[model samples]
Structure formats: structure tokens, C-alpha cells
Target chain A: MSAALVVLRKELLDILRDRRTLLLGFLLPALLAPTLSVLVPGWTADQREQPSPVAVVGAEWGGDLVYGAQLEKLIRVVAASDPEAALRRGAVQAVIIVPPDFTAQLARGRSRIVVRYNPADQNSLFAKQKVFQAVAKFSLSVVEQRLQQRGLSRAALSPVEVHEEPIPAGGGGLVLSLLLPLLLAVWALTGASHVASDVGAGEKERGTLEALLSAPVARPALVIGKFAATLALALASTFVAGMSQTVVTALAPAAWFDAAARPALRAGAVLLLAACAFAIAAMAAAWLLALSFFARSMREANQYGVPLLLLVMIGGVAASTLEGVLSSLWLAVVPFVNVVVAMRGVLFGRVDPAALALTLAACAAYTGFGLLLAVALLRREAVIFRA
Target chain B: MKSARVLVRAERLAKRFGTFAALTDVSFEAREGEILGVLGPNGAGKTTTMRILSTLLRPTAGRAEVAGADVATSPQDARRALGVLPEAAGLYGRLTAREALRYAGRLHGLAGEDLERRIEGLSALLDLGAFIDRRCEPFSRGMKQRVALARALLRNPIVLLLDEPTAGLDVVAARTVRRALAGLRDAGKCILLSTHLMAEVERLCDRVVILGDGRVRGIGTLAELRGEGGELEEIFVRLAGAGSVV
Candidate 1:
């Protein structure tokens, strides 16, 4: 066997024996997307279905006109002298303050109604929406009644009828298209980061690097072996995360899929996604391994690794949010962003094959550069013999 | 003695780390069937010389060869000819002693029955049979050293470079390592040992190379260095310089 293969086998075996790495590299990624997909929607649905408690300061003063029967059913009206205090303390989701002359003011022209709710609180925000809808409906009813008295139809108020015709949804609807690429970028970098440090700096810290270097193996072979191990672990994590997310998207209710995207699992699409994932994983592993080689110990590797990960994650988020990002050929040259943009394009059926090929080529180039840098660093006595 | 070929040779090796000169000028040779002790104190360039021999570091100037392979021109070949037991050599804690030896053997291109056979032979040779299958995490300093020794010898290297091989072992463990080195010397393997301990030199070295401030002060057998009969310590102190003695 080649020395690189031998070294790779030993490194992989070492990683397999580590329980912490196993948990981080495999188990955590497998559970991550499924947990978020299932739990978050389920929790949000429950919140939506349950009526929020709202405090109305002057319910009697409004005489059930402003607080109509339909509106009252959507929220349980609680009594409170200090409605604002109640909202702050979570005693109520929202506070609706109706003035004493609310009906009188409505007769004259318009009435002042204030809905106080915390925007930071989900339940409070939902309550505010419901309460505002009810008040608006009451005002519309009053306007319609007055219009009827004056022999005018509601059409008199709505002179121009605005018709909303949504453009046919493209790419795997907006949410899945954007979210999948972000997940891919995150897992690829995260998975590689987990093992790069251990494989590179951990070996030095444990004092095994010198022994390994003393072997008959070439320096490039040793580095390639270690790089392969790190890439394997990274690819494993990335693959698991992608598969989990795909399964979630497939199993999720159709209503959850935004736009026209609805879990389209074409062979070509799957292949494209797999290609994007592999490219991302390869680039991440090589970059992180290079950084790991530069570090003197595992602690220093982490200090370097975490920031790189965050920077990549931030780039991924930026790519996901950038409108029409896939159409731009310039993004195809950026490392993590290009992968994310390509993934989004693939998932949404907006793929530009030329752009994707460019992205792959760019990632390949970066990976090659990173591997070369790692090999060069490994050959440097100052780096290898660092205290 | 004249027929015994030189297996390890260093000629005018001078190394520097930018402004600091670690080795100014040093030369030595170890022949088959003998232990050559390179004696020096801390910062005496003992480790640096061993590192150069092991192909871990490059000498700034001069040349070195192991089993006829020049370390500078052909490091991989030089490494293949060497079995290096570095100072405070460490083991992979998760791997068993047997596994560690197998890994080392595989890297050297030994596999299948031959690799397993060599592992078994070294296990008996170093008395690693008791804990060969156990993880090295809880092994004592002596046990780890023995495992390291087994790994080094697995390649059947032409030249064995040991840097402070028994520096931290207990008396019993140190005796075991010393016995193993003596047996390897009798087996006709050239052993280049580096240490500052006078007793270690007195016990095992066929010839001593006394180094001070990266320069060789004396190189000869104990009897030859003693000349008119003197304590080895006094001679070492005098040759190596009294102020540099550790």
C-alpha cells in the first residue's frame, strides 16, 4: 500500500475511536435539520391556533361596538386597570385602550384606538394583528352603514380595485431555495472544522507529529492522508445534514413550501445538489486543514477555525438574502458564496450550468492551493518543531 | 573493528536559527555493532543533531548521511534507513502498543504476515508482551518508551538514533531499555545514542563524543580519553568545560 493510504487508514481509525468527534461529526448533524423543521413549525402552529389573552381597558365604554362579537372570539378579553403594565409583565399579550367617548367620537368623525403589544414577543405581535383587524372591520362596517344611508356602495371607497397576481414561483419556492444552500454551506464548513484541528494541531499537541514525521513516508503523503481523513469526516457531516433537510422538505406539508417549489426530487437536481455539496465540503476541508497546520496546537487551531466558520456562515447568509444572486456570474468566483448561490439555483431550477461549472472550478482551485500551503507548512522546520 | 562499516556519519554539520548558532561545527560517526554516545548538556545541540539525522530538521551547513543516504539530498531515503526514538517520544493513547507498532510497520511498507511477525518479535525483544494489547493511555513512562522503541525497530532500520532514550524512566525501566540497546548492538545494528548522563556512557557506549557549545571537545573510547587513568566524570567535565556541565 502507498504510505498515504496507510496514514489515512490510521488517522481515520483514530477519529472513529473518539466519541466526541463521532457525536459532533455524525449524530448532531443528523438530528439538527429534522429538529428545527419539525419543532419550530409545530410550535408556531400551536401558538397560532391558541387564542392570545388581551386586556381591554374600556370594554364597557365601547358598548360592544368596537369590541364586536367576532373580534371577542379571537381573543379572551382580560380586565386590567394598568393595561400597559399588564402587557410588560406578560399578564396579557396585548392591551387595547378604548376612550370613554369612543362611540361619540365615531359619530362625529373618527375614534382613537390604541393597540399596545410587544413586537419582540410572537404571541403579542399576533394578538396585535388580530385586534387591529377587528377594529378595522368595525370601522368599515360603520362606513358602509353611513354610505347606505347616503345611497352609496362600498365601491365608492375603493375606487381602484388592486388585483394581486403573484408571478409563478420559481427555483424551489423562495424559502427552500434560500434555506437549503445556507444549510449546505454551514454543515460543510462545520463538519470539516470539527476534525481539521484534531487531525493537524491535535497531532502536534499530543506529541505524535514528530513520530509520524520520522517515518519513511513523504511529507506530502502524510499531509494528503491527514487531509483525506478531515475531508471524509466533513463530507459525512455535510451529507447527513443535506439528506436530513431534503427528507424534511419532502415530508413537510405542501403549504410550508413557499412559491412554486414543492420538493422536486429530479435525478438531475439531486445530482446537482450532490455536486454542490461535495464542492463545498472539499473547499472547507482543505481551507480548515491549512489553517490547522498553521496553528501550533489544538487551542490555537480552534481560535482560528471558529472565526473562519463564522465568516463563512455570514457570507452564506448574505448570499441567501441577495436577490437574483444566482443570475450573477460574479458570485461564481467567490468560494463559499458561489457554492451557496449554486445550491440555491439547483434547488430552485434556476441553475446556470456554466456558472455552476465555474463555481466547481473555483472551489477546486482553492482546495488545491490550500493543500499545497498545508504541504509547504508541514515541510517547514519552524512550523513542525514549534513549541 | 576496521571491517565494520560506518552506518551513520556527520561531517562538519553547522546549524543556525537566524541569529542563534545551535551547532557551529560537529562531526562524528557510528559504525555497525557499536553504541556511539553523543554526550552534551542542555542547548548543546544534541537534539538538533539527532533531528537532522532523523530528517526532521535541515542543517544550515555541512552534510550528514545514514546508511549511505545523504540527509540533505535524499531525506526520505535517509529516513527509511533510520529508526528514531526521539527525546520524550510519545505514543497514540487511543491505540494499543501492538496497533502502534503495526501502524509504524505499515508506513515503512511492511504488511501482511511480515508486519505481524516483526511486531511479535519486537514485543518479545522489548518485553512488551505483558501490555502489548493494552491502550497506551495509562502506560507508565517506561512502558511508553518501550512501545516507542518497538515502533522504531519495526522498520529494521540501518541506523537507530536515540535521543535521551532513558532520560525519565525509573531505574528498573532504564535498565530494561539499556539491556535492549546492548542486545541490538550485539545484533550488529549501529546505534547513535545521545545523552548527558556520564553513567549511561560508562555503561553502554563503545566510544563517546563529548560536545560543548555545539562543538565536539573529545571523541574516543573511555580508555583512550582517560589516557593516564582518570574518572570519566572528571574527564567529561574538563573536556566539556566545567561551567557547561549539567
Candidate 2:
């Protein structure tokens, strides 16, 4: 164990000095989650704040009925000889055509306004929504005015009044429940594999492995020590990524989530998340180390490692898609998928102790098996001396 | 000679890699205060022999031991009793010579002041003071070899298995390494070095083991192998079976 610790200390120090590994394993992962979280929302909000430009045909026909009081704030009226041409050329986000008989129809208590917009363009789609809201508001105001003139209550327009109260879904908001687990698996796999390849096949390529193997240290001790280093970096990356996402989620605009049902994580949930991250990182480190040991060179290690990375990432995505459906004891025993399910359960505040125990146990078993395989590979002369 | 202890022994060792014999009935011994040279051409099993003694490779049909610890059965003990410098050994480029030596020492269970002292002694012995505190990435081939050698000798094992220790060095550096090996031998350390360089054998080996096609062709003191005072090259050429040059 002490020998293992010494090797661990040396490998960690070597990893720390490696700028590429540090950048990929820790700094990049730390920055990626928060950057995406901030950027996506910021970009969306920017788009929402800008008014969409639209061309109005027959603007004078309906007067206030055509462009309602909320119309100016929602859209900018752009001049266009051909409204459809303008919309297709992207000069205007949408074209509002007010028919010559709109006023007559309004007086008759019914009217149809044709709002032309490109469905493929985001700006055009948003403009369409705004125009619809504006027309609906104008119709409602006309109804209220007529009702008041007849001495009827304004509430008559909404006779079957509907009130919506969002119930907390137990899983921290939908995005967090899905996004966090996928992020954890990706960070853990990438983080562990980065250092694992460097320490395992990199040593073999550099010719340092034979010297290390010739040491009095046992093969198990050497493998465990290297595994510990890889695991340390993996855990650090997952923790940083998780914390970055958490901070972003905490500081995010409440309007982004269901105002009535914000995902709140308790202390117990946090502990379970940590345990889940640990299991994921441990599993990645063990298997990645085995793959690295199987490879004879760093390039070969990467060739072997990338497919496994893609496999886990695809599994994470699939599990996230099937989140609720994957809350079974059987899924808890699956490798990468189990992590996604457990993370979802933790975030959803619906922790199943039996399933969680099975997931953790299964991860531990895989890790042990992987470490044993790595040790066995290290002991093999053919692997150690492979081209 | 009988009073001297045999620290490295390879008894009728045979190693085959899936039918191609790498070492076939090859055997030799190195005693205390001796530098036994295993002389061979490129494919003559020199490295294979070194690897077996270093506990890196297990022989298929025979046993090898270092200081009575069987390399096959008691690898940890065998490794503890010997220090190896393989032909392709490399240093951690990120580690300084002192750091590399200290790491090797710690692995051999040496620590603190004792390890430091051992490292300092090796640094001076191997002429590593010029680059002891510097990282190995920028070191020249000679400097790298010296540091690697220092790392191998850090534990002061009873037997030293070196495979072509000065294969890539310039004259000055090779001379420095050769002098160090001679000093270590005089200090009662058993050194078994493999080399294709005939001059290295003529200058340093107390006894020479000539290997060709995975079999021992000759084994004796220089005079015994030379057989009535021929050039070492002619003897090597004849024994290695590459045919004579003219």
C-alpha cells in the first residue's frame, strides 16, 4: 500500500506538471458547463429582447384594429413592395396582411388576419407568435368595451377561468435532471481517460515502464497507484463540472425554470450526487487504465479509448432520453446508464435505496474487475513488450 | 575463485516466443567483483537474457535466479536483489535526475536521508552533478544514459544487470560510464552487461559469453576464447556465424 502511495504521489506530480492533461482534465471541464449554461440563456434572452421586423400590407385599412397597442413593442414595421418577397429574402421576419374587409369583419364581431412568416427562421417564428398575441389582445379589448357598453361584467369573456399551479416534479428541474448526469459521465470518462492513457501507454512508449516493472513493487501495487492518480483527476474534473453547473443553476434567472417549481437540492441529495460521481469516475478510471495497458503506445491507447468514450457518451444520452423509464433495479446494474438513472433519481428527490445500492455495488464490482484485468495485463510480458 | 559468491545464475535457460526460440539452452554466471560480458549480435538473445535476469521476462523451460531468489517464482525478491539498466530504459522527462533517483530509491524501500545519501553517492559516481537537479527532457543522450544509470544503481543491489549501458554515448561519456562500471566491479559488485561492441568486451569483461542464433557459441576468459591470440573481432565474427569479413 505504501509502495502504491509512492507511485501515486509520483504519477500525480507528473500529471500536475503536464499542461495538456491539466487543461483537458480540469480547466476545460470546469469552464465548459458554466460557459454553455451562461451562453445559451444569454443568447436566447438577447434574441427575445430584439423586436422582429415585419412588413404590414394594407396598414391603413384597419387603423388600431390592424396594429394593436402592443404591436410596436413586439415588431418593427419594415417597408416592402412585395411582402412575400421581403419575408423570403429575410428583409422582414414576418409579413402581416390586413384584409380590406378587416374593419367590416371586426364590426361584425369576427375577422381573419393572415400572418405570413417563414417557419424555418427563428426570428420569423417569434414574430408570428407576437402578431398572434397582439391580434388576440385587440379582439379581447373590443369585446370588453362592448360588454361594458351593455353593462355586462368583463369576466364574461373568460367564463371558464383556468388557474395553473405548477407542482414540483421532485426531480430538480427537467434540464438539471437530464443534463447533469450526462455531464458527469462525460467529464468522468474524459478526465480519467486523459491521465490514464498518459500514465499507462505513455510510460510504455517512453520506455520507462520496464524500469518501473523491474522495481521491487508488486504489479497490483503499481496498477492501483496509477489507478488512484487517474481516479483523483477524474473526481476533480467531475466535481468541478458539477459545482460549475450548480453555481450556474443557482444564479440562473428564475424565469428560466418553472417559477412555482424550482429544482431545490437538499444536503442529502448533494451527498448522493457526490457518491454517484465517485462511482462513475472510479468505473471510468479502472476501465480506461485497462485499455491503456492493453495499448502499446499513446496513439494506440487513444484509438482504443475513444470508442469506449463514445460508447459511454451514447449510453448517457440514451439513458437521459429514457430517464423515467430507466428507474429499475436492472438499470441500476447497468454501467454508464446506471449513473444517469441514479443521478436523475437524486435530482428528482425520489431516491430508491435498493436501486441506488445496486448501482453503487455494480460500479464497485466493475472497478475491481477492471483493476484486476489491468494488473493481469501489466504482468503479461507480451503486453509489456508489444510494439 | 570458489570463495567468491555467484550472485547471478542462469541455468540452462530456454525461452521461446510461440515456436521461435529467443534463448535456447543459454546459461552463464557472474560472481562477486566481476564484470561478465554477454557478447552477441543484434538477434543473439542479449536483451532476452538481460530481461530474464531483471525479472521482466520469464523463461519457458529453465530457471534463473538473482542472489538465490528465483526470478520466476519470487520476482519481488529477485527484483529487490538486482538493479537493471535495459538497453531501451528511459527516464521520466518531467523528473529531475535527483527526483528520478529518489523515486527509484523509494521504490526499493530507501527513504529520507538514507535515500538522499545514496542518490548523492550515485550522482558523484555517475558524474550526474552537472544535471542532477535538471529535468531530463533537455538532456543529451549521454546525459540521459548517465541519469538512467544512476537510477539503476541507486538501490545498491548485489547484482547489476545492464544491457548495453554505453551503446549510444560519445567517447568521453562512454569512457566515463566504463570507468564507473570498473569502479563498481572493484568495489565487489557483480555486473553482467550485454554488448555487441567487441572493444567493450576486450577492455572490460573478466569473462565473455558469445551467443549466436539463441545458443552459446563460446564462454571463457579472453585468452581462452581467443584460442592462441587472435583478434577479438575475428573470434566474434567466427562465433556469431555471420561469415568472415575477407
Candidate 3:
């Protein structure tokens, strides 16, 4: 164990001094999350705040439905002789056509409104949504007016009332939860790839493996030490990434996070996230180390690592895209997927202790298996002395 | 007179990579206070023999020992007693020579003040003061070789295995290595040195083991093998056969 610690210290010192490892594992990941977090929200806000113009046909016959209360504040309604041409020419994002007899039908309590917009166009889509909101409000006012004329209470317009309330409801945390797993997994892979390949295949290519093997330290000690260094790097990178994301989210405007619905960034939650990140980092580092041991050179190790990284990324994406708790017992033991699910559960304050335990146990098991494989590979003369 | 104590012993050691025999029935011994030379052509199994003694490679058919520790059964102990500089031993390019040496020392159980002192001593002994603090990446081949040699010697093991230590060095660098080997030998360390240069073998070896085609062609003192007037080269060529020396 002492020998392994020595090896770990040396390997870490060596890796830290390497500019390539520092850049890829530490600097890049630290910068990526904050940069994206700020830029994406800013861009989305700009898109949402922009005015959406729409063209209206038969404006005289459309009556108050076309010029309803406060509609002009949200949308710019323009009268166009040829609304389709105006829409196609980009003069308007959408077009609303009113029939010539639309006033007669409304007096008899019947009418139809046609909304035309290109779904593929973002501006058109936004315009369509604004028009729909205005129309719905106008229809509600007409119903209230008719009820008043009949001398009936406004409540008589509806026999039933419905209200929606989400379970474990929150908004700001939703984005963070959706992003944390993928970002952490990516950081883990980035960190592990840099250190694991350098220690495993890079040692062989540089001819340093023979000297290390000839030392009094056993092969398992050497492997464990290298594995520890890689794991440390992996965990450090993920922590930095997670921290950057948290800081960025906290600094963002309340409008971006729905302040009332944002969950407090509590110490217990942060600690749980850190624990999950550590488990993921350990699993990533061990697996990458094992794969790299089979490679004869760093280049070959990178080739093997790319596929594993892709697999991790896909698993993270799949988990984040899944709705609800993701507390299925089977998914709790599925490596990277489990961590993502557990992270989601933790962020939303709906954690299933049993599932989290299973996930952690599974990660521990996989990490152990990976380390054992790495040790076995290190002991092989063919691998250690590969030409 | 005190009997010579053998520090390294390879008894009928053999190694096979699949069906190809890299070393066959190779046997030799190096005693304390002596420098034993392993002389061979490029593909003559000299490196294979050195690797087995260093506990870096396991022999297929025989056993070896370093400082009385079995290389096969107790490899860690055997390795603990051996300082190995394999052919083309490479350094961590990102590390300074001092850091590299310290790392190697720590691996051998040296630490703190002892490791630092060992590094200082080796840096001075190998004339590494000029570049010891520089990263090894931009080092010349000769400078790297010196650092590697320093790393191998840092632990001061009972047995030293140097494979082609000066194979690609300039005359000055080669002389530096030869001087270091002589110093270690005089300090009573058993050194097993493999080389192709006849001059290196003639100048340093107390006894020479000439190998050819994975087999030992001859093992004896130069005087014994040279007879009354034969040159060491002629004897080597005669024993190892024609077209063997490169």
C-alpha cells in the first residue's frame, strides 16, 4: 500500500506537470460549462424577447376578435390584402385569416378562425403561439359576455374546474439536473483519458515500463497507484465542471431560473452530487486504465478510449432525456446510466435510498473489476514489455 | 582468501516467445566485486538474458536468482536486489532528471531525505548537474542515457544489469558510462553488462560470456579464451561462428 501511494504521488506529479494533461483535463473542462451556461441562456432570452409580426386578412369583418384587449402589446397585427404573399415574402411571421361572415356567425354563437404559420420557421412558430393566446382570451371574454346577457353567473359557463400541480416541482433545478449527468460524465472521461493513457500505454511507448516493472514494488501496487492518480484527476475535473455550472446558474437572471421554483443549492445536495461524481470518476478511471493497458502506445490507447467516451456520453444523454424519477431497480445497476438516474433523483429531492445504494454498489463493483483487470494486464510480460 | 560471493546466477535459463526461442539453456554467474560482460551480436539473446536476471521477463525452462532470491518464485525480492537499465531505457520526458531519479528511488523504498541525498549524489557522480533540472523531452540521447543510468543506480542494489548501456553514445559519453561502471565494480557491486563493442568488453569485463543464436558460445576470462596469442575478436568470431557479429 505504501509503494502504491508512492507511485500515485509520482504519477500525479508527472501528470500535473504535463501541459497536455493539464490543458485537456483541467483547463478545458473548467472553462466549458460556465461559458455554455451564460451563452445559451442569453441567446434564448434574446430570441424570446424579439417581437413576432403577424398579418391579418379581412380585418373589417373580423371585429373585436382581431383587435382584442392587449393583443397589440404582444404581437404586431398588420392588415394585408394578400396575407399569404406577405408571409412568404417574410413581411410577417404568421397570417390569420378571418371570413367575411365571421361577425354574423359570432352573433349566432358560432365561428371559425384559421391560423397559418410555417412550423419549421422559428419566427413563424412564435407568431403562431402569440396568435393562439390572443384568440383563446378573446373567446373567453365572448363567453362571459353571453353569460351576462342571459343573466347567469359566470361560473355557469363551466361545470368543472381543473388545476395542474407537478410533484416534487421545481424549474431551475430541472435544467441543472438535465445537464449535470452528461457534463460530469464527459469531464470524467476527459480526465481519465489524459492520465490513464499516459500512465498505461505512454509508459510502454517511452520505454519506462521495464524500469518500473523491475522495481521492488509489485505489479498490483503499480497498477493501483496509477489507477488512483487517474481517479483523482477524473474526480477533480468533474468537480470543477460541476462547480462552474453551479456558479453560472446562481449568477444567471431570475427570469432564466424561475426564482420562485428554483431549489436552494443546499450543502447536503452538493455533498451528494460530489459523492455521485466521485463514484462515476472512479469507474471511468479504472475502465480507461484497463483499456489503455492493452494498447502498445498512447495513440492506440486513444483509439480505444474514444469508443468508451462515446458510450458514456450516450448513456448520460439517455438518462437525462428520460422523464420522471428513473428509479427503476434494474436501471440502478447499469453503470453510467445509474449515476445519471441517481443524480436526477437527488437534484429533484426525490431520491430513492435503495436505488442510490444499488447504483453506488454497482459502480464500486465495476471499479473493482476494472482495477483487477488492469492489475492482471500489468502483470503480463507481453503487455508490460510490448514492442 | 575470502570466497567470492555470487550475486547473480542464471542456471540453464531459457525463454521462448511462442515457438521462437529467444534464449536457450543460457547459464552464467556474476560475483561481487566483478564485472561480467555478456557479448553477442544483435539478435544473440543478450537482452533476453539480461531481462531474465532483472526479473522483467520470466524464463520458460529454467530458474535465475539475484542476491539469492529466486527470479521466478520471489520476483519482487529479486527485483529489490537488482538495478536494471534495459536496452534503450527511456525516461519520462515531462519530468526533470531530478524528479525522475527521485521517482525511481521512491519506487525502490527510498524516500524523503534519503531519496534527495541519493539524487544529489548521483547527479554529481554522473555529471548531471548541468541538466538535472531540465525536462528530459529536449535532452540529447546521451543525456537521457546518463539520467537512465543514474535512475538505475539510485537504489544501489546488489546486482546491476545494463543492456547495451553505451550502444548509441558518442565516444565521450561512452567513456563517461565506462568510468561509472568501473567505479561501481570497484565498490564491490556485481554488474552484468551486455554490449557489442569488443573494446568495452576487453576494458571492463572480469569474465566474458559470448552468446550466439540463443546459446552460450563460450564463458571464460579473455586470457583463457584467447589462449597464448589469439585476439579477443578472433576468439569471439571463431566461437560464435561467421556472420554472427554485426
* Highest lDDT scorer: 2
lDDT of 2 at A366: 96
Least well predicted 10-residue stretch by lDDT in candidate 2 chain A = A254-263
**Poorest stretch of ten by lDDT in candidate 3 chain B:** B237-246
* Tens digits of lDDT, candidate 2, A1-387: 289999999999888889988798878887897666554764676666677788899888858855663355777788899889989999999988889998898888787778899999987898898787777778778888899999997787677888987776655666677678888888999889889999999998888988899999988999999999999999999998888887777777765655433557788888999999999999999999999999989888878878887888788878856655754798988888898789988987788899999999999999999999999999999999998
For candidate 2, write residues B144-183 as lDDT tens digits. Answer: 8888888888888889988889967899889989999999
Per-chain TM-score (chain B), model 3:
0.96
> After superposing candidate 3, which stretches have Cα over 4 Å from the reference?
A35-42, A53-172, A320-327, B1-3, B227-244
Residue B34 C-alpha lDDT in model 3: 89
Q: Which DockQ value does candidate 1 get?
A: 0.80
Judged by whole-model lDDT over C-alpha atoms, candidate 3 comes out at 0.84
Q: What lDDT tens digits, residue by residue, belong to model 1 across residues B20-60?
A: 99997889888999899898777778899999999889999
Candidate 1 lDDT over A235-350, as tens digits, reads 89988887887677667664454435555557888888888888989898888888888898888987887887787778878885653544557888887888888888887777
lDDT of 3 by residue, B47-70 (tens): 888888887788999899899999
Q: Please tell me which model should have the higher lDDT, number 2 or number 3.
A: 2
Clashing pairs in 1: A171-A348, A172-A348, A173-A261
Residues A250-285 of candidate 3: C-alpha lDDT, one tens digit per residue: 777766655544456567777777888999999999
Model 3: residue B67 alpha-carbon error in angstroms: 1.6
Q: Compared to the true structure, candidate 2 yields what TM-score? A: 0.91
Best by TM-score: 1
lDDT of 3 at A356: 88
Per prediction, the TM-score for chain B is 0.95, 0.96, 0.96
